[model samples]
Target: MIFTVQIKVMPLKDLLDPQGKAVMGGLQNLGLNNVSDVRIGKHIDLQIEAENREAAIATAEEAAKKLLANPVMEVYEITVS
Candidate 1:
């Protein structure tokens, strides 16, 4: 079976996100002061070949942990469909 994997990679909450901060600054400059603590993250989409949904989820989780996200600075969430 073929599975669709969706992964979201984001900076750890305790870590500083320069890109997000830059965007937030830009937004505030544009007079969007109501928005606060903006965060930016990466979305990854890929197809995986697996025997079942459970296997596909496991594969994607492993991929996220091993290659897609940096454990030190980033956290990842995986969804398989």
Candidate 2:
């Protein structure tokens, strides 16, 4: 069966996100002060061939851990359907 997978990768909370911080600073400069702690993350959408949803999810998780994210500094989540 073919499944659709969505992956989200982001820096760990304890790590600094310079790009997100810069964007947040820009937002404040534009008078949008209500927003805080803005974080930047990556979204990946792909299709996979697997025997079942469980297998799809497992494959997606492996892909995320091995290539999509830096396990040491980033966290990843996967959704399969």
Candidate 3:
């Protein structure tokens, strides 16, 4: 069967996200002071053919680890539907 896989890739909390910070600064400039912080990340969707949800998640996780996300600086979450 085919599964819909979603992966969220984000910079580690301990690491600084320049893009997020830049956006935050822009927001502040626009008078959006209520927003205290921002974090930028990537959302990836994949259609995977697998026997089960678990297998689909595994495949998406491998894709996240190998190419989608940089493990040294980022973390990823995988969900299968």
Candidate 4:
């Protein structure tokens, strides 16, 4: 079976996100001061071949851990469909 996987990769909370900060600054410059603690992350959508939903989830998790996300600085969450 083929499964669709959605992965969200984000910088760890304790880590500083300069890109997010820059964007936040831009937003503020645009008079959007209500936004705070902005964070930027990547969304990855991919399809994998697996026998079952569990297997698909496992594969997506492994892919996220091993390649898509930096375990030290970033964390990843996976959704399978």
For model 2 the local lDDT of residue 68 reads 95
The model with the greater lDDT, 2 or 3, is 2
Clashes of each: 0, 0, 0, 0
Better of 1 and 3 by lDDT: 1
> Stretches of candidate 1 above 4 Å error?
none
Model 2 scores a TM of 0.94
What do the candidate models score in CA lDDT, each in turn? 0.93, 0.93, 0.91, 0.95
Candidate 4 Cα lDDT to native:
0.95
Stretches of candidate 3 exceeding 4 Å from the true structure:
none
- What tens digits encode model 1's per-residue C-alpha lDDT throughout 1-81? 999899999999999999999999999999999998988989999999999998999999899999999999999998876
- Compared with the true structure, what per-residue lDDT tens digits does model 3 show for residues 3-56? 998899999999999999999999999999999669999999889999998888
lDDT of 4 by residue, 16-68 (tens): 99999999999999999899999999999999999999999999989998899
Better of 1 and 4 by TM-score: 4
Each candidate structure's TM-score, on Cα atoms with residue i matched to residue i, is 0.92, 0.94, 0.95, 0.95
Model 4 residue-pair collision total: 0
